[model samples]
Target: MSDTQPATSQTAAVRFEDFGLSADILRALADQGYIHPTPIQAEAIPIVLQGRDVMGAAQTGTGKTAGFSLPIIQRLLAHASTSASPARHPVRALILTPTRELADQVADNVKAYSRHTPLRSAVVFGGVDMAPQTVALRAGVEILIATPGRLLDHVQQKTLNLSQTQILVLDEADRMLDMGFLPDLQRIINLLPKQRQNLMFSATFSPDIKKLAGSFLQNPVTIEVARSNATADNVTQVLYKVEEEAKKDAVTHIIRERGLKQVIVFSNTKIGASRLSRHLEKEGIKASAIHGDKTQAERMTALEAFKQGTIEVLVATDVAARGLDIAELPCVINYDLPYNAEDYVHRIGRTGRAGASGDAISLFTDKESRQLADIEKLIKHNISRLQLSGFVPARSMDRRPRYEESEERGVQAGRGSQYGRGAYGSRKEKVDPWFLKPYEPSAPTTKADDNGGAPQSSSKPQKAKVAALLGGVPKR
Candidate 1:
């Protein structure tokens, strides 16, 4: 018993003011200068405000945050409080994300939207000191945004309570499953009251996501702004085939040739992300890497720097880059094509966001043909393959041998005119012409002996034999 609402082209005619949202919410939207809602927001905001369980599926950057955040704020404002007592603000709405970045991003959105209202909000995640989080939790907040593990940690420590939480939102449910957060989700869900509103949103609607939604949501509305596993229409997708060893150089060449000022390069592995970041830095690009190996502080600093234009390139892994909402990101380069075809969709989704034109460029070697094909099949469209013209795969000059360096310097200083005998010493030696002649045996001397059959074998002189018995034998 679920309602299916397909997004329409007419959604463009809808405005934020028509949603019947509160003046506070509308004022906050106006503050951010958001008058019109994206397709997902147009469809989801009204339904979410109705307090019905919702299952939203949309492309990554089509205003999913505001779709749920605004209504949740409007609904929670009914119970909003200005009391000074900590008990006045109990966790009423809980938003769970798969990654810390997403949690932090969602928390920022919720805080901004709720700024004009009395609804207090807070976010908690791992990778940093929990002292600050514990303090915030003790201070009390109505809206709590957290990753499942961190939320459970706070619950276990008794610093937070969710028994009175009224609404539960699972953002990026598919990613949570990929991250193996099902058990955690179950545990956290068990801790909440069963009579709460459930809202789930994901980029793709896989079977596992559907099953999870069936189990968790009660007669929810299914909202799909685009087809499942669909790439954005505005994104220009292209691929460049390169040799394995030349992939790094290909990235540098592409960036330099295109003069791209701001872009995110997605790597499949943390090590690959870091390596690409270092390579770009060496190539004189302002680049930084964000991955699980980096501390939370370092990741945040890099993200902030990239957003502020201090870093031109933000190379990141899938997990680290999940839920990143960068405004007007012009391009995304896939340093390594993702193994999972669905990830390819998410990778490219980083660009072409919010109806903006973007380029999704990927560099793949021969070995990634299967991955490429799978991605094509999943997206139901062929990505244009282009040759990387003028890409000569830079060779490392630092690896030159010592002798070569000295020889080159000598030649430059007029020490030698040629590479062979002058720069390096002569490599040739003198040889005798006699030793070069073919092998020949001398003729045997056979003179006047006409009767000699074999020329008497050419014998040499022989010494006389000694007596068999000496002194005593003579007397005998």
Candidate 2:
């Protein structure tokens, strides 16, 4: 059944109390200051409560997590036990995310929603010691949130079992495919019981996602709270054309011009994210970077700092683009346009959350015209191209040395460097004086034998060179 009817204001008027959820769940919702369900939540909660499979699609910041989580908790409460034994709290609901950050965020939401109830929830992902997670798993939890790789790792270690998992949620299924987690997903899905209810939620739906749902879900109800591949209506999007070398300077200038206190600058690569973060810090802005290359603790620390207003800007890769819920983020800057058009929706979605007005500022170079066009095509509209007035480049600001140093650490020489002509910048390599010396031949000295027959060499016999084991480099 299709739940694609346009959500009117009437839906907005619907309260969470009307769902007939457990008092504990309602109490937890109240504690979080949430009363009314968002459109997606309003639609999917009831369907999920009926024990039906769900394929849910909604733009970011539409409360998709609670839409499925609240119902999953409600369904699992009937079997929830207060027993301390591990068997009493078997993992009944399992949620999988593509990245560790999203997994942890979902875990937080799940823990908050189920806190007042007897249900126990635990989250497990890589980049941390597994001892704690193993202990928690052995202690038993009714709801488990994890990434595919770590989930499989625990399974291999015999610390987790999914045969009894009665409900499955693939949050951000499209991103999982993009991150090459399809095989891991397939392996995890195979371990679960065939009769479990399935729920797949994402901001955008693609052909691969549909095929995945068809394979796993048994006639799941399709729920679309917004148009497919649509951006948030509350976000104002704009693009500025700049030279590739000037993008970092533009970012700094934008933050300064607007006096933005809380913003996330999205980069297409981890190195780019780190570099931009360093630049902002050098410009006297409190900023941090998070990406796949960062440790779980580091990423979480940066996120917590950003949320607590300790950091003004958080430069990040796509790992933080999805499932990052920051209240009234105000704005998000794109240091580099995303390679995938769908990612543009998610990147901007970091801001303008929950009906809050936000601005999405993007910096695109001439070479990224195709990426910009793709983003515009996906959103079904042209972004407002604005000129940066009264902005000065870093070179003009007499920061040419800093620019040159950053370029040296960037792309290799002879390549089309974004910052400058080459990392060396017309500098010549220094030659060592030893290499200029001419080669000379020396006559071997011989020792005369007492027999006066043939002269014996004075030098000792040289040992034959031996090859290293395992086909490694040979000894000199």
Candidate 3:
């Protein structure tokens, strides 16, 4: 559980039976060909089975679903009656995911693990038929996995109840915040019982996550399967410095030269993803864009096509890319680098899953130096630069931060620095030498005080020589 410890290896020697799981759960694991327990599962399971809250941090494809779900299902089954029908069971466990893809994946794993048990569970999310979700909720189940948005919709529609939920799991908590789900999470938590075991899981537990935990979780046991926000060790990061207008050419080159068969190209925005997908299509590559605007059906169809090699490339925005469980994906290309450094970690995480080797290539323009720098600092490694034969960038030498360019320069100006130089070159800090030079005020020396108290100046400087030396203010 310590941060310095190595990632929970998939090949850890621990066995599922070592944990106090039910026979049905062990049977299900054996059926799934999982004889060994992953580090997260081995470390967190016993604690979870003890009914204590847990904050789990692990990278994707690290068998985290089993880490919490196995214990949860086991605990629920321990309390369930053998004679009671599942249709009358209360929702004892609640797992909330940020995206529909993740909710479905978690639901599938829960079902698979509980295949032999008497427990029943259902998944609900947005962008699909709610009638089916409502029907499933109406039939009492022990577990409910849902996305924040769709779960709230169910609550508002009077089709679901969380008051009876005994266990709460926030899977992918960071992505939930990234997608603006904090408010929704609070609303859902308020609906749940006051005393319930809370389990929070994320690739990274940033300060915001800690604050969320403070409010929701009791004194919790922390488990770190991998360092927070750390990129997968199997992912090879590659950077390409290209002119802004030449990113299209660079993509085509990477695909043709490296013979990349299937790649997920990430963009910073939905519109950018759509544009890049169209451009790649015109460049003779089969491509499709996936983002929040696209319906869940469309996103799933595109993903399925990409997985089956029907589409060579899939372009997507950051939020839209969450919960994309693509295994053995050969490569991930950043058509545009993400604004958040942590996103770079998650973006490349899509590839290099389940201990498979993969590549993460990012296209960088000189104008995006700051965003690029942020990624390097986050992962704590500089990506190796790859200069293609025909795509040498024209402005690749500009090392200035993103704020030094165009509209952002004005913001830089407001800071301490002056243009491109050192801090505070303004006149207030260093008075102009011309004004500070030896020069007396040119005023009427003997004009008896106008009001009999003091001498007054009659006229201003005529030739403007003294005035120019005094910063255009006539000496009186």
Candidate 4:
């Protein structure tokens, strides 16, 4: 089944009233100026409201958050009371995210939806103190949105409880797995009650995601609003094949030439993001960097500045690229190719939101030809290669040579060194990198004792005499 075709597109445009949502929720939607349901919302809301497991796949900016959040809030309000009683148990719903920004965004949506309702929600993530989170849990919350690592930490510390959770939602599951949170996810899943409802939402689902969904969901009602890995048709995508050294110049030229404002530039690494931001700053373009390495406060400051238009360009890693709710952002630039092909969608998905036209530009060097090809394959389209004036490569048709012999030698050396014997011990055989090995502390060593006390060394006590015939000095 494809997500592109709506099962009931011919049905007259759906209103929030058609979904039979609670009065408070409908009121909130009206406050937010949402008059009609998006395609994903129109289809997924009814199925989720029925308490069935749902697997939804659609590009970002399709209102998936509201699709699930609205129903979740409605269900919670119907089953639970908001009388402000101490007996009102907390944490009925748990929403897991891959990044702190997304966690906060989800929490914001939940709060907006539940504003008129008496239900309470809180967002928790790492890189911030735990005292506030602990207090929030103690006070009781109906919905808890958290990142996986911090959630696991709370579980380990007994600061949060998930035993009473009736609904579990995994948002951006693909990105969570990509960040190596599968183990933590499994741990969290094992702690939850097995009979509770499961909702897994992702922009794209690969084979691995299907396997994970199979393990967690039972006869899920799959709702896909768009084809998997398909870029939004509303986004205009283009690429430039420039020399490695001319990328920054090309980016600057394009920004000025196109008269673009409110742009997000994606870099592969934290350092690269900072470097790009600095370069843009030197060129008199205000910019900032947001990544895992930055403190929570700093990242928030940068985000606020970007949102307020104090900064024109925001350079960021993939963590900031997902689930960002910036309205009407005009452009997204790929300064560095993503290691994962799926990330291209998430990165560019930052733009073209809310039924607005957006532009996505990619810069590729000869070294990144394979990565470019992978991106094109994932999007299932050939991105038109454009040549920017003053930034074209010196050698347009140059192909980098393959260093097969050097690669073979490096592999051989790695095998030899890893298998070679050392003074401590021999290497373990067939070590799987995926396995998490426990750490073991070594025992302390003791020197020999003399007469029940520690041994003492004598100063200049012994000397080696040289033979007289050699006429050599004595050694001590």
Candidate maximizing TM-score? 2
Per-residue alpha-carbon lDDT of candidate 1 for residues 340-418, written as tens digits (9 for 90 to 100): 8998888889998889999999999888999999999999989999998998986644321122111111222223333
Give a tens-digit lDDT track for model 3, residues 347-417. Answer: 89888887899998988888789998898888787889876766553434433322221111112322243
| Model 2 C-alpha lDDT per residue in residues 86-155, reported as the tens digit of each score | 9999999999998888898999999999999899999999999999999999999999999999999999
> Taking the tens digit of each residue's C-alpha lDDT, what string does model 4 give over 3-28?
22233442537788898898889999
Question: Model 4, 62: alpha-carbon shift in Å?
Answer: 0.7
Clashes of each: 0, 0, 0, 0
Greater TM-score among 1 and 3 belongs to: 1
Provide the lowest-lDDT 10-residue window in model 3: 401-410
Flag clash pairs in model 2: none
Highest-lDDT candidate: 2
The local lDDT score (0 to 100) that residue 374 gets in candidate 4 is 97
lDDT of each: 0.86, 0.87, 0.81, 0.83
Model 4, residue 121: displacement in angstroms? 0.4
Worst 10 residues of 2 by lDDT: 404-413
